[model samples]
Target: MGPSVMKKGLLLIALVVGGGCALFLYAAATRGLSAREAPSAAEAYATRTFRRWAVPANARLLRNPVPPNPETLRHGMEHWADHCATCHANDGSGKTTIGTNLYPKAPDMREKETQSLTDGELYYIIRNGVRMTGMPAWGNPEDGENDHETWTLVLFIRHLPQLGEEEKHLMSTLNPKTPSEIEEERQEEEFLSGKDLSKHKSTNGRKQ
Candidate 1:
């Protein structure tokens, strides 16, 4: 073939391969972020900086969360439904029409297939957020329980896979608040903050 024709053929093949990659990643986008050009040169080479602080590469589920109590679960369910279900989904699959649009994508909790970390790491990720990765920090210095809420969410998440279809259906609207639990919740929310949260709830969480 002529050099000109061969060069044209190679360019077309390159374009097709590049386009396929774009579509593949587009299908993989997580959370609510939009897809566009690929990450910048610096971003492409970047790795998790969270390791400096002991955070893991992937989210970890806790094993013995204190107060795996129903009240905390109720709190987590509510918080997740309002704040997270849009992307992570009520089931934590990180699969949703919205979540799949995000750039780096979201984590799917049920797929213990990909997870490898500790509960503390997951709590830190929830409270401190992962910059540029679409994960948000839950706690502000303002709301005392935001960190508590973060851990609580992680604790609840650890329980996902073990939950039967009935439990999931029930979770669609379950509130752990009996009058007694509500009283405890009201008091706990008023009193807990920072590291102190570790004491009020027990178990820290366990494997699903």
Candidate 2:
């Protein structure tokens, strides 16, 4: 085959393969993509492939302006506890209820699949988020603060496997508390102070 003819044939094959994949994905979506069910091996591979290709080349090459220092990591740790720990957990092991239930599920950042990604790719994903996934676009273009925070988060992600017990404990304290947890703490404090629990119980009963 002539060079031009061979090129045309290759393009045709590429188009056919792409269309077939798209149709397959559409069928899967229509069949009800369940968060509880793990994705098939093929589906998982395709998703990862698409994500890698989706990031722009320039973005992938961009360097992290924020230095990965102790202070930056500390800030990242605090931010992760307050904002990300609900889903990603303090250890970056997406094992929390929300993370586990997400369609396609959150990834364990400490794993090779995540750690192998380029620094810029990680930053881009954090800022823009992956489509058709539970991850949200957390970085705000209008807010420079968000950019700095996200860069720090990337550093913290790199430190996940090396996270210490003390750091986890600090993060646990910083994590947002549910209303029930807050009330439980209050009651515990009152009990420790020898305050009457009967009055609190009667007040709650009246509200109910």
Candidate 3:
């Protein structure tokens, strides 16, 4: 209320922030900066709180323009399968190899920590990505106000809580497979169907 009290409040805030940073640095130094170690509860809370504050106030208030529908949700699911499943997984579990190994590890999107975020916050994170984490910014500067794909993704995130087994199976089909995985599937299918696998061999002796 008064200048003296306002100054004291600011000083107290500054002291808390400085102390937190010092402790973080000490932990990093003592803990040896290992990715395998899960973040402490305090660290996790601070990071989440900081991320929430980092988003612009206006951006947080913005709403998804893409209307949710079966078609749109399918499109979003497909996009997620091809692009996001590597880290987030088809069920938004964030349990894949890459996801589990990250320093902070990818979040379990089905949980309240993620689901509690507003659609706008989700969209912002999807488009802009959080700094100092594995997420990369996906927004194109040219897209401007017409980022329909990102908005649709927000809908899919909301749908994650209700993800069905069939939907996960479809997403697996849509996931980007490595060449070896494709070849393995082909070989398995041929063997199961009793097809002549040898006839498909190439000159290099690799499967055609």
Candidate 4:
């Protein structure tokens, strides 16, 4: 075929593919992509493909500088509990109400799909959140201080499969407490310290 004819053929093919994709998206939008519903196979594939390509080659190859020690693990656990537990859960299972409701859904880190990623890849995702996903960028790239925290998280992600119940219990304490929880802790401490319990009496004369 002549150069002009070949160009025309390729252009026609592109137009056809683009039109089909537009129609599919339109149909999906009308059908309702509910947050509570699991992502369709095509949606999952496209999201994964985009994420795979989004990370730079250098970022994927970069290694974690922080050593995987008990201290680092503890810090990572505390960080996860305070900041990530709401969505990811203490065990990285992503089974929490918020995690399950996200459009694409938070992935369970212990699963092969997540564990298969390299340390650097995981770090990149943590430092720079994936687009169109609930995961947020936890680290400021310009802040050197944030790098260690994210690297530690990468180690923690690796440790998810081996996470212990004792560690999870410890994390619960580190997790952020509500005002009611803080007040309850204060009252418990006072009671243990032999403070007057009469002040805590309810209308029925029972200690609340």
lDDT of 4 by residue, 28-58 (tens): 8987667888988997888887888888887
lDDT of 1 by residue, 35-113 (tens): 6344555754454443435564443433434578888887777777678877787778877766776766665777753
Models sorted by TM-score, best on top: 3, 2, 4, 1
- Cα error, residue 16 of model 3, in Å, equals 26
What does candidate 3's lDDT look like per residue over 130-197, in tens digits? 89999988868678556988887889999999999999998889999999999899889989999877
| Residue 67 lDDT (model 3) | 88
**Relative to the true structure, how large is the alpha-carbon lDDT of every model?**
0.65, 0.89, 0.89, 0.87
Q: Enumerate clash totals for all models, in the order shown.
A: 18, 0, 0, 0
Off by over 4 Å in 2: 1-32, 143-146, 198-208
TM-score of each: 0.51, 0.78, 0.80, 0.77
Per-residue error (Å), model 4, residue 2: 44
In model 2, what is the error at residue 104, expressed in angstroms? 0.5
lDDT of 2 by residue, 1-208 (tens): 8999999999999999999999999988887656788788999999999999999998888788899889999999999999999999889999999999988888898999999998899988988888889888886777533388999999999999999999999899999999989988988999999999889889778453
Whole-model lDDT, candidate 1? 0.65
Candidate 3 structure lDDT: 0.89
